[model samples]
Target: GAGVSQSPSNKVTEKGKDVELRCDPISGHTALYWYRQSLGQGLEFLIYFQGNSAPDKSGLPSDRFSAERTGGSVSTLTIQRTQQEDSAVYLCASSRFLSQETQYFGPGTRLLVL
Candidate 1:
């Protein structure tokens, strides 16, 4: 199967707008994750979804950030009332079973909040 794919590879929005980023995981992958990387910073875990279990969203930076995975395959991350500090590369990754397994990552969506 194909690797993970994300829509809108690049986005530029106003400071007060909202944005939706989408991710399509590889087939049969039961674990998915979202991460953010700022300039000169390491990847920051944003959310995690595994099988039918509840998603671990503790990594979300604030109340305006949220995500959801459907059927254990596709996931979407939404950021409301974007700010300049929110500019970063949003990355999505998936694995066959668990977080400890080999994970495949997608080309991140670069978001620039003006």
Candidate 2:
């Protein structure tokens, strides 16, 4: 595959609504990650998945946020009960392995929770 691809590049939702963001990682990459970047802030790790094992979701900001990787290729992030402060660019990245190496990132999904 060329690179990671995210759907619905831009999303706008009313407060208290729910939304789902999708990511399609490059083929053969076994390590995937999700991150969020708020305006005027740095990227924050949200979750990570390695192979078929349980994802490392310690970085999720709250219980309202969740994600899942299906078949080790595509992943989706769901935000329940959205709030204005939840607006940010959700990013997805993937690497061949979970080692000290460079990771390729997607263009990111810009989410706006009004």
Candidate 3:
């Protein structure tokens, strides 16, 4: 019954560096999603993966952002050439599917780019 989890909980990085954020989603979840939330802002969908559906990467901010999911359970988001504007909480969530069901979220990996 392990829930979603993210490492460090917080990260500080210099501008133009690279950072990798990890996410462990709940077991048996076939749908995984990556989202970003700025201070006081609503959640923005970044990418999503379902059982056999092609990964959706429409929300990726730019070329510097990429993500991959292995075994359909664990996912990692890598941000290259980090920018001050990238400072935000990178959140990961998973649900039975992207529908009426609620998507459980991890505590989040907070990135502070300076």
Candidate 4:
């Protein structure tokens, strides 16, 4: 797809399980970011991958949350030992560069941990 795309638009998992969410950003976009939106938190940044530089993971809530982008194109966010609090909409976005004014956002993946 030409635009950013995410797999498994909806995911339901039990607490203590692990889940991997995927994202495919627009071609040639050099900056990619992961975010989570929940009831308490409107929107929070999770991770950011820009080009070959080390990803900025300061936004991650804990060690259980991790993400990686390969070939500067596809990225994956993995949550290990998921908890009920981990349930939220995982969003992916990409831009030609971090300085770009406009970012392309994917249809987020809704995760429900029971």
Candidate lDDT (C-alpha), each:
0.90, 0.91, 0.87, 0.90
Model 2 root mean square deviation, Cα atoms: 1.0
Better of 1 and 2 by lDDT: 2
User: RMSD, each candidate, Å?
Assistant: 1.2, 1.0, 1.6, 1.4
Misplaced by over 4 Å in model 1 are 52-54
Q: For every model shown, what is its TM-score relative to the native structure?
A: 0.94, 0.95, 0.91, 0.93
Tens digits of per-residue lDDT, candidate 3, 52-78, equal 353567789998999888887778899
Clashing pairs in 1: none
In model 4, residue pairs whose N, Cα or C atoms come closer than 3 Å (at least 3 residues apart or on different chains), thus clashing, are none
Question: Best by TM-score, which number?
Answer: 2
Candidate 1, 14-102: lDDT as tens digits? 99999999999899999888899999899999888897454567899999998888777788999999999999999999899885799
Location of the lowest summed lDDT over 10 successive residues in candidate 3: 49-58
State each candidate's clash count: 0, 0, 0, 0
**Tens digits of per-residue lDDT for model 2, 1-114:** 899999889999999999999999889999989999999899999988887554567899999998988898899999999999999999999999888857899999999988
Candidate 3 positional error at 40, Å: 1.6
Residue-wise lDDT of candidate 4 within 1-114, one digit each (tens)? 589999889999999999999999999999988899996677898888887454577899999998888898899999999999999999999999888548889999999999
On lDDT, the leading prediction is: 2
Off by over 4 Å in 4: none
Candidate 3 C-alpha error for residue 27, in Å: 0.8
